[model samples]
Target: MNELISPKYQMKLAADVEKAVWDEFGSYKNVRNYIEKWYEHDEQNYNWENFRVVIRDDKNIDLNATIHSMPGEILLKVAIDLGVDTPDFIPSIPTFKNEIKSEYKTAYDTFTKAYKQIESDPSTAIGLANSALESIIKEILKDKRLKSKIKGNETLYQLSSAILKEFNFSSTEHPKEIKTIGNSLLTANQAIEKLRSEKTNFHGKTNEDFLIEDALYAHFIVNSVATVGLFLNKFYKTKYPKSEPEIEEDDILPF
Candidate 1:
């Protein structure tokens, strides 16, 4: 059997196919149809198992985790590996393709910026990193609530405390930390109540007794805030069309 095509080659093929369909049909529907036909035609000889195989399972792929690899590299690698052919005439691989690229670019840029913040501006980085950790903790809490696993709250709380300390917040050992947690908690009780009423899954177990002690640790370490901030910005802009995104740019390396 032939060796699996490299990701770059796959992308070139996909791009070529897209270009041809665009020249012939000029719309996404037509392009998709052409792709479908191409796939169907090639299915008899094609080996589909090459790219989709889970070579090494990475924990960061989990949805609840706050930090994960930026999607640009993943998509680029997948595209190249799949080697979907695009025709030369297609102007761009349709709006959807552009949108995915744009989203990935934003994520890549944000991570790069956060990394710079850590080296040049520690205080800002701390805030960004802490916020991300807190958000992860909230997500863990929410998931636990849905699963009727609120008994794990103490663990979550301890994890959150440690995460906060890592971001240069107050001491995890202090008694007042509990009070602080109550005050600075990211997810609102009201929202959880609303979810309980509307979402069948939320009502399974409805108590906040447990703390997700290791949640943040499970997701990220030093740059938690920047990661979370990037997510929040993207999510808010997408959800609230009226609000314009505030672009955050840090000092670029002279090189």
Candidate 2:
């Protein structure tokens, strides 16, 4: 007896097929044609707007909770039944579970949204990514009882500085690792600000100026921000109850 492919693998294969069709067609309308090749209804539109309109009518829809996945996996089986060859392409969707503090869950939710929309809506992805980072910083500051020190509304710069400021690492003998991580955080922060101010969905443009490559770069930077934010989240854990916040860079060995 031949072995049957698992359902998860079958879905993965479907995504690969859809990805191939997307790469080849390079247009949503054509992709829709590939999707509904043997459509029963002449009025069936596979456009994103039409899909959204259909999903909106659901009575028990959960909008706040985000599902980190994409569309077009079903197209794979249909294409296969039509004798279309499925290409081997791996999806770059990230899969990770975040068990964060209750106060920080909102930040994590935004992070989830950022990842969910990274490939489709690049501008929204970047904005949500920055918001997640900012939310995490605010949570950290609130935890540390340092919010009182800053008066008035704080910008992303201030939020970033709140984390990077007065850290007991610069003067340390081997602060290279910490320095590198700090620089990554700082670079991501600055890039998020620049990207939001110039491009993102926050402003007037309807993502007309944004491209997929730009979204890819934004995704990379946004993930970089989360990397630093989570590091800070864990780093502050030592000072949760009474202990002072400390820096313990593991790879700080002397030459």
Candidate 3:
């Protein structure tokens, strides 16, 4: 179950558009308009960037397709694959303004929610982040491309670095650190599944695939949410300190 809604990919897409604009005409007035229009169009066809091309051991298999989503009509189509009801799903083509609005608000809402939650419970934040990261890594490791190359947790971090780089983060601090702080969530999930298979009342006797899928989805979601929260927290705390100990007006240039 590939979770399709990716804010990280969306951010990279916007950045790429900005760079392309800069390279073409220097700059544009707030890419919001362009972004809105792009969303209005389908995004399924959007080509993924920042992906590695891996060579299979067989040497005959070709896995050259981009792993990311696209802009315009393409992305909208991808949303359908999620089993989400859209214009294509309905004959009347129900207005999706609400859906669009919700989509737009998701990241900001997640950031705010995570921040407030973190402020009240720092331990919770760290725990949730670790749990989520572990889950995502488990799913990733299961992929044939990754499974073949990765022998242990160390190589998994290397893969995480490659993926996280697309989101503009370095693997040195949080990436590798997160990987080391805990083992793969897959192991834990598998253990739980095995216990459940034994019909252990303590394990709740739940569906294994559903449990793993839920964990994997939550893993990606929580990390992205926590990451945005942390970034915003640092930005505000550093830039707008409650106590002004230093002053340098020139440090910030006037827009």
Candidate 4:
């Protein structure tokens, strides 16, 4: 069964199965009884033998191991019965906005909207993804007191370069590999901006204009945003760690 399903899907299914078993049934014995009842009434024809061997042991069942070893199809059925939706195994963008110290709700919301509309409206998704990245960069710059360096109408590439320079990411002092990665990130940001303007419906495209219609392109852009956003955030934090507030001796009460 593990050999049949991809590792990503297997992890997602295992997590869903564990959640359903614990949240809905509360215990393995209860879920086993529920499945047995279904079998008794001919409600489901799922092969009980495989499930029984993993779930019906007398000792405390190794739930994690059991879930991982269960057949993928059977686990999916259990997930459905327990009211858990089948997991969509896709690349997940990290919540890079949370790492910012200042207001970032808009950027966070925009990124979420971009992720949700990736399949339904790829053009809008790409546009929103680009906007989210720009918003994040601006927020970071503002937080670091570097927003004044912007010339009011800078492109995504320019903004990224400014922030990267602030973090010394574009410095010649770094290793060759780091320099290559930084250059690549700058290029990716530029590409995303280009895609949003020329390949999307963001600027009111004409009928003759080419628009991105495939979700794969949206996925690529979103992931690119994720990569660049995360790199910027981590590098910024490393370069400028937040200072810990000093406790006042006068304010401290005697224990």
Candidate 5:
């Protein structure tokens, strides 16, 4: 389990672990034994002897280094046991059931897959994040009016551009700040599209091609998908509110 996490992320995770330990157990008193117990019962049967050395000094464990070197799954487990939130780098997907009348199942499923593999399979995660955004855009265009405008084979950026135009997000009639935000979102979508084709495992890579192995890249792409997906869903609802059915009094039974 040679997992190489970003040094900055490792520091944050280490700090959270330290805070959780102090809050729950009141200092590093016998904290090493507590951690050892978890490893002992772990189904994978991790190498406890090596982990023991990492946290040898109960009061002075080099937690940042230990976290950086530990496997991602093990680190998540430790965080769960200590009752801390997952690291901020791991983006969470929102349940969009209430946000929209139609469900974007492909978007949700793909984003979930990306979130789950961010640490162990960064390249695949990046690809999945790109797919997730594409799915969201397709769902938005499912309306008959919007569907007529697209050829159904547009790229991610093209789909995003169509949606933005439909929402009047890119219209010059709006304030400069709003237009700027919309332009930035379009640019970000383009970047994700390029990253997927060139750096991810989505497309077969040649020996000369460079691949993204860092979790940081995957995290950024996945977070972007979540942000863009949420924004699109909210904006779609605002622009095209689902109309409620009219109930006739004559059709209702008297109480």
Candidate 6:
């Protein structure tokens, strides 16, 4: 005697799967629509950057889920065949405006918010600078496929250097300050690093308080990093795509 009923078990499985699919689709309708649009337009053609806008700004969906909802399960199946369960899921696109990515709005928006506090509480400005640094770091790591390496308990200071190492941008290749940037970055990391621990959000704690100059410098360092990082990220991705990292090393870059 099998412990299963024909009509009941079949109905239960079908209903559960249908509900699961419905829930998944409902939660990510914008994503579904974008994916559908891609299919409707040109099944063979797609741009990761434009597609990223949809993911970063609207869907907020992870890469795998987005792949699964791809034009027709083609890319998704290829990924599965490649044994990739968790691929490099890029975060909010850097749109430079409202026409740009929305997730990044928080980081950029902080600059203005911090400016307001510069006169009264410069420490808050430093805090916002720290936040921007954090945002760009996460963005860079996500883009470079190194975010997972930075654990939850890790500090931004830790990631600052680690990101550089992971990016493989040597002193000579560094866009700015070849020799001095490393030590300077180390010191900046140390100083701003404390911002994460010390309670400097409000007006208090003389020892932890930051001055206007410090806040301004903090913004400078972070903004510089973001600018340079975005440049390097885009450059490296084009030069050393995952499919063939050695292609540039063997063919180009030597010149």
Best by TM-score: 5
**In model 1, where do residues sit more than 4 Å from their true spots?**
1-113, 144-255
Model 6: lowest-lDDT 10 consecutive positions? 85-94
TM-score of each: 0.19, 0.53, 0.20, 0.64, 0.67, 0.40
Please report, in order, the local distance difference test score of every candidate based on alpha carbons. 0.35, 0.55, 0.35, 0.70, 0.70, 0.47
lDDT of 2 by residue, 1-255 (tens): 002334565565555555566567666556555444433333446432312211224443221111112224324334433334333311221221153535578876786666656555777777877787777777667654554355436767777766676344354664699777676666768777778767776766653675334544654655666566666666766555456667678756766
Better of 1 and 2 by lDDT: 2
Candidate 6 segments exceeding 4 Å error: 1-103, 170-179, 195-199, 202-255
Q: What order do you get sorting by TM-score, best first?
A: 5, 4, 2, 6, 3, 1
Alpha-carbon RMSD, candidate 5: 8.3
TM-score of 2: 0.53
Give one digit per residue, the lDDT tens place, for model 1 in 1-255: 013334554445445433443566665455444333322122556644222211225411121120122132232322222333222211222221333244445433333333334323433333333333334444433432122233333433354444333333354555786546544633332222232233322124345432222312212323233333344334434543444566556655557
lDDT per residue, candidate 6, 159-245, as tens digits?
677766765545566666654665566556666757544646533556556434443453344344344445544554565466734
For candidate 4, the 10 contiguous residues with the lowest summed lDDT are 34-43
Q: All predictions: root-mean-square deviation over Cα?
A: 20.4, 14.1, 20.7, 8.4, 8.3, 21.0
Evaluate residue 134 in candidate 6 and report its C-alpha lDDT on the 0 to 100 scale: 67
lDDT tens per residue, model 5, 13-57:
767876776567654445545655644334466633334326554
* TM value for model 4: 0.64
Q: How many residue pairs of model 1 clash at the backbone?
A: 38
> Positional deviation of 195 in candidate 6, in angstroms?
5.2
User: Considering only N, C-alpha and C atoms within 3 Å, which residue pairs clash in candidate 4?
Assistant: none
Name the regions of candidate 2 deviating beyond 4 angstroms: 1-97, 144-148, 172-174, 206-215, 239-255
> Per-residue alpha-carbon lDDT of model 4 for 1-255, expressed as tens digits?
235457788688789778777777777677555555433222365533554334445665556776676666566455544545432533336344444325567777887777767766889989998888888788778764554466557788888888877776667789988888878888889989999889999898888999999866776787778767877877766777778999999989998
